[model samples]
Target: MRFARVRLAGALAALAVLSAGMTQATAAPAGKPPPPGSEMRNVALDTKPVQSSTYEGGTADRAVDGNVDGNWAGNSVSHTAQEEQPYWQTDLGKSQTLTKVAAWNRTDCCAERLTDFWVLVSDSPITARTLAEAKAQKGVTATKVAGTAGRTAEVPLHRKARYVRVQLEGTGYLALAEVQAFNDEVIASPSPAARKWVKDNPFGMFLHYNMSTYQDEQWADPNASPALFDPTDVDADQWAAAIKDAGMTFGVLTAKHHDGFALWDTAHSDHDIAASPYKDGKGDVIREYVDAMHAKHLKVGLYFSIWDRHNGDSVELIQNQLRELLTKYGQIDYLWFDGWGWQVPYSQVPYQPVRDMIRKVSPRTVVANNDHLGTLRTSDVIVYEVPVQGMPPETNARPTDASDTLDTNRTWFNTTATGAPRSASDITDNLARARAGNSLFLLNVGPDRTGRIPQDSVDRLKEIGSAS
Candidate 1:
């Protein structure tokens, strides 16, 4: 597991931004500090489930630390021999009032099985200690009534505990998904606020798996013949299940990479999975992906490259293709449109056309055209591709989150190839560094010649999960 240090240039720019905003206090809103002596220590204990937040219709792709080629359906699975702590912790720096504590899970309603939910609180920071130490801690757990999927548990003001932790125990079973915490007793947020939450999440998973695996390239040219596209095991459920296990908030799969190869059966495009060698050339990869992810109550992100390397489609033709993709897929949360070397001189013109098409198709969806062509181009979330090093300052034009750096606010995952190896210390430190910067680490475990994620990537991801 090899790793690269974050480039200094991006760090400096972030510092500059901090300096500009120095006058504003960066503390949490007014709240009473926890009582003295009863401080938060070893907070992430096994007695209570951690409150996690997850986006619906999302996907995850990876394997467990000790296991190989296995994908857990959801993240809430409990550990009997060893209990891994959740990724987050809270310190009662200052005791605040006691009104309401809301817990946010991956979804409001369960797709099938029911999971027991509770909030646990203790005056301690959950350290990376042994499970025995955590079990010894003094904490309180509250059982919560399950609500609809993607909704919050707005339980009334209960007794005030010095420390508060949200726990979700599977209904005597493994629960796959996320849980998040809310300070307010009541949960209320406008659309923009919700968008802020998504942006704040910063880190997410971008999965690039398809016939491209056989091609051994990112995406094939749209003009490339379908005869060249093929896959042996393309399991949508596995992809989503792996991602959820890795504790990723959401996933953006390459429904169609730059090659213009549509994973789903698209009537608008002759070049797609239906014309490929998988599932008798009759499967809708995107539909299967959407259904699989939605069943787990995860948020969905579709990646459609603007430049079709294979389709041989002209700029105008590609625009029409994108329109069809956007229109065909309903209830999408995020649309990832990359604008890198792919957008040369001629390819730039289709930007607005693509943006207009996305709005017409899914106006509610958040479109991130990081390179400056999409409608939300000026939007706060921009993806800066760190080719070899970290993100460059030039890439931080707007309030964009640096994609690979540790400093990005929301979810900036590491999408580097997985062939190489880095030291464990480097990987651990860099991920910690990223979390310190308020960015979530995204590990892109590229798949092999087959559709499965490479063993090396899966191994590295398990290392990360173990550390978390």
Candidate 2:
């Protein structure tokens, strides 16, 4: 949200470097003119870059290094040797609400290689390893530039994206001088579907209920006995009421965690509440939590861990559990996935297959995967662990939320009575900070051993609510 130039301070060095690439032609490249707008900043300058392939000494970084040297001999042009749909991509650091993309073609020779190139904007990181995989990822928008966009070409782009790719179809060779991306000083927003969760539900509660809660630790052993999970006095209504009274809009219950313990009576695995003594092994914690949240007219969220230590890289088992939750639970609004990309890479359990299943079962559900992916690369929103990551950014480029514990010691699960909860002033201050950054604040309130919110935490929540 701040307006400034991003064209790094090497303007003089860039000009000196570009001179070696130019030919006898004194005239500049020809292209369409830019439409009216605020001052433009080249976001592509010196940013992280990659391409389909590197030819000779031409790396992807040359194109975006603020050098428009058109000749290959100048070492400023990026030439991709691979033939199949060659492309160049850049990460703009964060999501950018963009306006236009200006691409400079090779001037000395091989200008034909830049013909019929496309400008693509994507929400996540792209895969150009295979032509089939590359073609399948049709981005948010793809603008085709005719061959006439010769020399200096300005392609109109009115959209938002984090990753921008410059691609050519049926590539014999893809060569480029420079690529500059401009923005009109507006931060890229999340999709309209996400407005409800990130914009409307700005204040939410994180219910850290799981085997970890019973075992009195952040993460309990995978082999922890299911019989130890007994919560004889568990009350979902109390949890829901306390959240509602605190003026929160949503709650994320831990349906299953890294230990492979399912809170519901999941048929996929017997390591669930059904195997426990709660309600004589007939308890469905998710069922009660969902019903209670819905009764109070609040959005529902479920936290499911992808890195199941007990299950051991079982993708099919993950899919079946997700299917059960989506189909059985009515209108679940959010899913917080943990230990996917950070703990376990996506190569083991591909992100697309799991994403496809979610799209089919519940298209509207917002997924906030807590895998420490800084941006909204593989998730619908960014999850900032307030304790671990400190605080959310001063300005968020995409939908974001900060999750922290109310316990003064910052324990996520109930290890002891929350006798010293965060003060109302401290909690409300963070809430205001997140709101100012246009993000949600998911403050955690862990329930104690008897399955009841600590009275001190409840009273503090009310105090914050009153202050608000």
Candidate 3:
């Protein structure tokens, strides 16, 4: 179940709050509070995680390990035995202004075990050995989550506290895949380069064409056989033409998604196009896509999932894959990364080295990381996924981009019954919203199993083209 950080699985459920009297809101994958200070820092990484009791091998340290992967089977969860009231808390070494607390649930199974929970902040030390005594120490009742159905969840807590705790009131086993604490709110500002990026690419296309396309599901299992990735008439040219006709300046293709199915043949592993029947184990979708984009004088971008359920993860693999994509394919205009910080925190795949690698290979390429953490420290252009986080605020702190599926289907890929494209008005409306929010809109249109964008989607793009 350790999918290469398969965020496409939709594990996070966010609930946002502002101070005590502000109206509480329900959202998906909320961000840091909007205040100026140090960058959004995960204070938990510097502290030790403690819980009431450990269940089996579920140690409290697992929750602070920077992995938001909700699959307990992957050993990323912190577990506490069935008790009257169980709790997990971490110390900040000193009193700090806490912005928000995020707790991940066990998604592999028994997610209800973490049903009802509360995120409490206390200025006083939570030194009490019992839950009652601990609750007394909590200075502020940050928020109490009624029940969790395993969706994207987070809350903004502008409380100053030395200790933060996630506790359950009823008797039940407590399993947390991960727990994260961020301090200071996010203040927005666009990097000089990011501003230029936004200027050049205000609208683009997102092609979700991969193994998930063959499986007819939103997300394919990590162990899905590569043999299923058999596209009879895959045409990257058709994709480029569609985007060009749509009046889009750029396009990003899913070179590899969270399922770890790389589109290009690589030395990293065999879980890619090389393993499929396409081109007789020599197919290179990245090559075809890049060349096609260049043919139409359109910018080329590649969507790379940092988490991998198939080939596994490592900095070496990432660097090698980047080298191949950048060098072999010529200049990649932009690189859109997924599953970082949100799924597998940057702690695992440190940013500086990867950033240096990209700079070394392609200095002009821009980065759009979907970490869901709104800080320019990571993304060159902060990406707001429409389905996950409705819209980027008109006051977005940094250069921004927004993404949403054109298909009406729930998932990102084509399924048994192909999805109809969203209405042109709906598509254009979001585009306007994106621009108002200082973002470029990258609308996803997944290609069907035959390796072609559906006629309906192409027609929709034409309609959008006319509207533009």
Candidate 4:
């Protein structure tokens, strides 16, 4: 029963000869078969991968070093740090109904973890396009497949595509072991019924918090000391209950703000609740928030800032912590991110990591970056945080649900402070306007120096709650 190596090749050759007439892509030659008592299941050695380059050095400055195998030598794409596009375009030789994308990790001996990645498909090669251009163009769609637990990414195919590209972007080094593309029928776009469901639910909360909250400021203030975090009445449960009472369906709290202060307990950095001054600082705000929201049957969201004010060397630290948050938390429904950051330039760096985290942690939850491109890329919904309401419908302002709707599905919602409420009528008018446009109204309440929701705000919420 022991088959020599040569016999395995021979067996593959025989299979290829038998299948040649029916299949377009040729199979590997039959060779030495499996050894005695060994089992090989579903082993189809048809297409072997060819390595183009290996980036082992810090940046892409060093020479590309790696072996080239199979047929992808000239067809391979080399990525230097200079090569802004981290994607490799490959053709299946003929038109293929690609159903899946298998990305191989080919890195030098020193390559670290992969920071992030995304898959883009088009009948033609994907050229660089701005957020604007990507929005305007059609036939180009991408799905984020990084930061997930698995390596294989299944892409349903509806239309035939000759060329497929895998774009890798993030903090880590780069290399591609191999890419296997499967063919199948392309998938149709989302239905109108799905769009309608999301549009009806308007008015959600957007919480922007960070270590600055430790300083009682929005963003990190360099002049402020980290020890300034002292809040006696920091009860997330109360916040959630207040939101629920006001008829809000979901609440998005800032897990980490621009100052990189994580609202929850984190293993990566020391800047978080662990270091705060609430109840000797043993509280995890995120945990309480999640528990409270679930208690109220309200959707829970975590807002993270891609921008960090503290040390920026820990990109890997950042991603690992995020993975923990998504996997550990029971059910996070949304991921909100900012575009501007200290480490990566917005234009140069892609938000694939954030998108990937959302997909991996909570596939059902929508992921939105600060840039409107979130609407174009991985986000199922669009959010315009503009305060002005009842503006005439424009293309940029058009709803994802309908062309005529000023605020339709994937629509805009207001997330700004409503100043001091001179009277209950002001709050009522703002709420009515938001409801009229079919948009969510997220009113901001600036907490007092003690980190307690202002009594006036609480009174106002009570008034609003009674009205709702």
Candidate 5:
């Protein structure tokens, strides 16, 4: 196979492929082809058994257990105490050329514990007992790979070796969901099908209708009486009709916001719609919303806030809520995660487990985190909330969406005082700008406390749709 050596300034030089066939192989009937230019094959699957420096509650074999849901954790304490570094290793049975190494971090909890690591490949047996000894070994090439919070670290190793080792750098703990080694093939970014769908449906509606809507607050107090969350005239069909009339292809409803008040009946939380007086404690807004969207043949999306003021920032609780949403709904198209900076930082949140659960339940659901950037490496789409300008510069490598409110003011939820709706020209201009930058434009409209969108916003959206 032909190869090219790529040397980054002041860093270790490694070989990379200049042509497409360097990692290309025949595809199985059921297997999809790798993205355009790269060929990737997972070589760590069902290979020789794996070994680790230390483990707790499980063997090192769990790291290569071929189960994305399972994980291997270090024996060190979960706190911030400094301790010896942890490591996991496996012999490939025979020396083989390697291209990339992907290590999945623990997603259920303690995701930030695994950070600043090294992927080492050696021809001889890896005899180093400690992390320092493993790094000091001669004739061994190593590539430093930094962990991305709760995402996989797919490090490229353009070298050859029979033994592969992953050693942690700092204190905390060493945990990994799975470790994979690829020979010559690299997975493509943002599948072509996904990209095309986003391009085709560039305009969607963001329905900010939740318990907070009744309180006229962006973030309602968690202790607010559940009886106050009463919508007199609930009409999911009207919301769907408004969006369809606006020429939007999809709609995202606030299923659960920062208040920890669920719009659907959740068995895990008593503070959900089922506990509220709406529909005599028997309402399921999510069900009506899903049915309405499906009847209109429009895609359905749900907004779930990661920060929970009432739930006390428990990782397992967040995961359980996500499981309920993903499984209860038949087929959700998008999942919008919001409220980042509250009690727990995004790094500490177990995003990978939630992401994995979403994939397991609804494989086609597009995941978007409100990182407030043009794009994020971990999320499928980057979201910009209330952009003053029409759209941000096209800097993100993935699809982007600019979400803003119809009202001129910053109010996300309903208010008694009505703000002037953006003129049809203004809405059209924003859409044009978003399309120019290859981004989706999500226009927000908050329904009143009585669960009905204002007439002015509906008329404005219809005007905007006709102008387009």
Candidate 6:
């Protein structure tokens, strides 16, 4: 697939006001690094179980039985035949600064059945007997919990609650093998270093050049001939130069898109740059991009789409590719996952395994799923596509980035034709709005098919750079 690169030059000067923006959004204290002598302890084990509804022999108490082997099946058995909203909750005995909740799925089969759900927290006791009654309870703070293919789903809850509940929204069996909870003193935020990076460098550049650039399509057909993919003069140095001139702190390249074309040479797949005519099938775009960014003192990021049209969806395949990207590259500062709802729903995608792999391979790399799931409570960062007017409200809770096209027409890939780029004044205003809302503004500009950013676009970027 193709991506565009945009520069936000005045971000450094905007930080002073941006800091104030973060304060205006919320009075809550910023997340602090974990103190010494901190450890996670399961607080929900053996807690009293409360349920809105349950299937045959699947009682609420079974959820907290401490036996992960026993599955607690909810009301629905089939997708078409299911409860309006099945739910299960537990009494934490007392109010606590709830940090995280881990839910285990039945491993025998049909893990995809439990797709979308929510984790609700309440300070007061929940006396609701039915699913509808439980959902109607007031003063209950809830966070959406996306389903996963892995056996367990761990979600962080940076809120206070005495009663924790899991509510299912989809039309399918709402089953859980186990439910565990922990307080902040025990469990801490996963990536504090990554969060600091976002706060320090609020603006970045996105490079979208790939096989699709040759085809002039957003997503190239997988069956298309690999020989057609070729750039006349691909220079990572030129891209890095533009980024540094624009005052961006980091750059993310599309290493692999929905079409499953790898920009880097990979031994795993034939549908990669290694199969293309570029560099006589010996070139490695990712290696060059990373080196170029490092040479410019800019952090490196890679974009990979989980939905692959060329290679059929497989968790093993995705993890293998991720292992290569995380291990082969020196260090990936950011990992962006796009094409969420195209091939498979976000819940069905195996995020737990991927997350584990990222943590193991590159502990510092920040992970962002383009699903816009939630603010800080959701993914590492909330990514908005073509947010010209500005980002939506609730995005202020966590670090956020809004990406838009530099060309007013909103094209992602460069065309032979030229167009007027967004004016400097307009671009800066967009940055201001993003900053005020506590978000980084990522501007996109498609490089030409010859692997060269259009001269007009570069000129406009230079104007933005100097003006900022």
Provide C-alpha RMSD values for all models, in order.
Answer: 18.4, 16.8, 9.6, 18.5, 14.2, 13.5
Worst 10 residues of 5 by lDDT: 1-10
Residue by residue across 78-146, what tens digits does model 1's lDDT show? 222212322222444434334444333322234232234444444455442333444456553344556
In terms of TM-score, the best-performing candidate is 3
TM-score of 6: 0.60
Expressed as tens digits, the lDDT of each residue in 1-468 for candidate 2 is: 001112222332322332232222221122433222112456787798998888987899888865454656556588899687888989998887677788877766777888777787777777655444655786746677877446566767766778888888665788888888976542223456665678889899999888987887678789989998988678899999988888899999988888889999998888988999999999998999999999999999998999898877678999999999998989889988987765556666766678768989999899887654343335678777776544564444467778888888887788854438988999999999888766799988888778888888889888988887
Count residue pairs with overlapping backbones in model 6: 4
Which tens-of-lDDT digit does each residue in 1-468 have in candidate 4?
000101122222333222222213332223432222111111112332222234432222111111111112222223434343344445455565444555533222222333356666666645553323432346666766556312223444445565565655543334443354544321112223224434554555554444554443345553344456666676666777667766667777767766677767788877776776755768777887788889888887777766666635344765776787788878776666553321334333334554555566666666544432212232344443333111111212212311111111211111132244335455556556555544345544434445455465567667776776
Per-model TM-score, in order, reads: 0.50, 0.63, 0.64, 0.50, 0.60, 0.60
The worst-scoring run of ten residues by lDDT in candidate 6 lies at: 4-13
lDDT of 1 at 93: 45
Report the lDDT of model 6 for residue 153.
63
* Per-residue lDDT of candidate 6, residues 259-282 (tens digit): 889988777789999899999999
lDDT of 3 by residue, 336-366 (tens): 9987766655656776678778888899989
Q: Cα deviation of 244 in candidate 6 (Å)? A: 0.7
User: Per-residue alpha-carbon lDDT of model 5 for 324-401, expressed as tens digits?
Assistant: 888887888888887542234545664455566667877888887764322233356756564322253443245677
The CA root-mean-square deviation of candidate 5, after full C-alpha superposition on the true structure, stands at 14.2
Off by over 4 Å in 2: 1-189, 417-419
Q: What C-alpha lDDT, on a 0 to 100 scale, does residue 235 get in candidate 1?
A: 69
Residue 248's lDDT within candidate 1 is 62
- In candidate 3, position 125 carries an lDDT of 66
Backbone steric clashes in candidate 5, count:
3
